[model samples]
Target: MRYDDDPWQVAIWTSTDGTAWELVPDLDSFGRAGLRDIASSDEGLMVAIGYEVLPPEEGSQDPFTQAGKIWRSENGIDWIAVEGIAGQFGDVAYRQGEWVVVGAIDGRAVIHTSADLVNWSTAMLDGLESALGESKAPCPLTGRQRRNGRSLAGWPISAPPSSAPQLAWRSASGAGMHWVGQVDWAE
Candidate 1:
């Protein structure tokens, strides 16, 4: 199991008999902007996300307004840092052949695509919103969304990391929608 409580903290749990449980923390540690979503990739490795954060204290200033960070682990229990990624507090989903992460920037969602889960490509998210046309996708460390919505405002609330078709994330909504998204490897 994973940490569904806080986006910044990651934990691995194991139960051989189905009644006992133990938590494991990985070593692939890195600074987090907000620490949002986590997913297992096709390579059988665990991936953790990081992005822009509100800073430790509200009154304090964050040198970097928002940045992205990525962490990976070979086993579910131990983690390692992936070099060079930016963004904070958003959503992470494994899709097609890459990781689709979404985060907010200046009150709007910024989207980016990554293939190796280490380096990232610029995402303006023009297909989704205009404000993001020329803006870079904000890195999200932790994001959450419901499962459904009846109106446009509810878009992010209904789409989250899904656990169907083996293991993959289907939601493509921009950062604006990442509210409470969590990793669902098993549905």
Candidate 2:
């Protein structure tokens, strides 16, 4: 869960039974950030993704400057913050032995993949530019798992002239994803 204050704090809690919970501490060293999503593998690896808030620039009107942040844990108690990958990460999911994080970089949609959470590769979703139109910024991405061993990523795209956003989706089993079309939620 996340704290309601600035320098947005995040905490992880564990419970052997649903009745009692304990908080994991010392995560403050990860810096000023807010977590967006968390995922765990069957092998007991946990990954959390979010954006790090950078100090505001002098005389700047917008104070929220952000960089992507990732943290990994093996035992759910000890977490190590990862650095270097760039983007505003929105969501993460573990599928087929790989960890996939979805977000936007420079206003463009991007997907990051890693097998060990140490080595990562990035792919830009150029197709989204054509689908979302020229003037629109990249929408936040969310990942969901299906019972059939497939994963899905989706985002809302505005039509034009400020119309209601439509939800577009893509399906993936491993590394490749194919467009699954969009749904008009306004109807």
Query: Across residues 14-83, which tens digit of lDDT does each residue of candidate 1 receive?
Result: 6789899987655335433345567777877777676433344455444334455666777765567677
lDDT of 1 at 86: 46
Flag regions of model 2 displaced more than 4 Å: 1-7, 16-20, 133-139, 158-175, 182-187
Score candidate 2 by TM-score against the native: 0.75
Q: Report the number of backbone clashes for model 2.
A: 0
lDDT of all predictions, in order shown?
A: 0.48, 0.69
lDDT: worst 10-residue window of model 2: 164-173
Strongest candidate by TM-score: 2
- Per-residue lDDT tens digits for candidate 2, residues 1-187, read 2232464667777779988998887777556777778899988888888877776666666656667889888876566887657788878888768888888888778778888877888877777767766655433555554535446666756535575433333345454755555434332
Task: Indicate the TM-score of model 1.
Answer: 0.49
